[model samples]
Target: MAASLLYPFVLLAGALQALGNSMNAQLRVALTNPWLAALVSFLLIVFVFVAMAAVRPQPFPEKASVAAMPWWAPLGGIAGAVAVFMGLLFVDEIGAGPFNGLLITANLLASLAIDHFGWLGMKPKRLGPMRAGGAALMVAGIVLIARS
Candidate 1:
């Protein structure tokens, strides 16, 4: 499947992410601590997901399944905390548009590496010419957004 075909959904997700980041930033400001905001977010996430699981009646994940993962598998949650905290820190400095552009650009480059290397059990993908060009174009767009 072509990435372009999935771009719309990804774009929508980006918009939602922007909203979440802004909301979380405000929470950080109100609480006067990024960690508190992250804690609140985690609490809310646990509540919602737990409710969802109950509604759907899915079986709980086995301990063995979780134990099968590498020790660093839990770092993804830590990464989310870092991302949200940085968003809180930089959004006020750079404005939402520029911050989002830079953040998304960084994520794009990191994602390219992750995909190409098949990190964390993901299927390996070649860094083809077209994909590289697309990433370059995204970087150009990010620069333009930041400059504006």
Candidate 2:
């Protein structure tokens, strides 16, 4: 599918992500322990995925396919959890706008590097002038957001 066609879904996801951070921050405060809050939040996710898998069972991955996976492949969840944990710990302190701004700005910067280098099996896209300009604009926007 063309990326433009997919853009709305991504936009919705971004909006939901910001909401989730705020909700998670509230969860942390209510629980009074970041670790417990994160666990409760992620445990629900685990249950939902497990239920989905059970309902629509697929063949287990072939041993060869499993063996071919990189060691870092399973770490994606860990990385995401770290981000969530940070949000849970700090979102209320920093306020949603600035926190989300910094988070998204960092994400964009890292995404640019990842795309430029074609890391994690992505197709290599050169850091051309337009991409660079877009990144600069994102940084500028984040600065304005953070200051506001």
Candidate 3:
């Protein structure tokens, strides 16, 4: 039961990561001003929420449910908005393909470190030589791509 429950969460995480990268690329191409991009992104998010509410209205959750969220919870969306704008601005300097490859590689390394260290309440996993080799290869590939 637990394994089955976890599968969807894993898939969801992967989908979110891919979507974020693609959206970053699109945002870079679409918006000249970072502030405007952020505003537009937020407006779109608001529109989605409003549309959903209109389609299937639901009562607000209890105060405790809302209050239980950490301060960083809200900051995550804001930070992602800023990151997309910044990535768009800088992507030309580093070719988009190479930059995205490097970004994915970096995200993998960071996630591995977080998982291995048991950061953020996650269970620790052993970091083996295979993982290290994979990371090295990813970096080398990024370098080659950027150089070309």
TM-scores of the models, in the order given: 0.84, 0.95, 0.67
| Model 2 C-alpha lDDT per residue in residues 76-146, reported as the tens digit of each score | 99999988999999989989999999999899999999999999878999999999999999999989988
Give stretches of model 3 more than 4 Å off: 1-31, 53-71
Model 1 per-residue lDDT tens digits across residues 1-148:
9989999998899898788788878888899887788789889988999899888987768999988978898899889777777886667778888888888889889999999999988899989999999999999998898888
Against the unseen true structure, what C-alpha lDDT does each candidate score?
Answer: 0.86, 0.94, 0.74
Worst 10 residues of 2 by lDDT: 139-148
> Model 1 compared with the native: what TM-score?
0.84
Q: What order do you get sorting by lDDT, best first?
A: 2, 1, 3
Clashing pairs in 1: none
The candidate scoring highest on lDDT is 2
Candidate 2 stretches with Cα past 4 Å from truth are: none
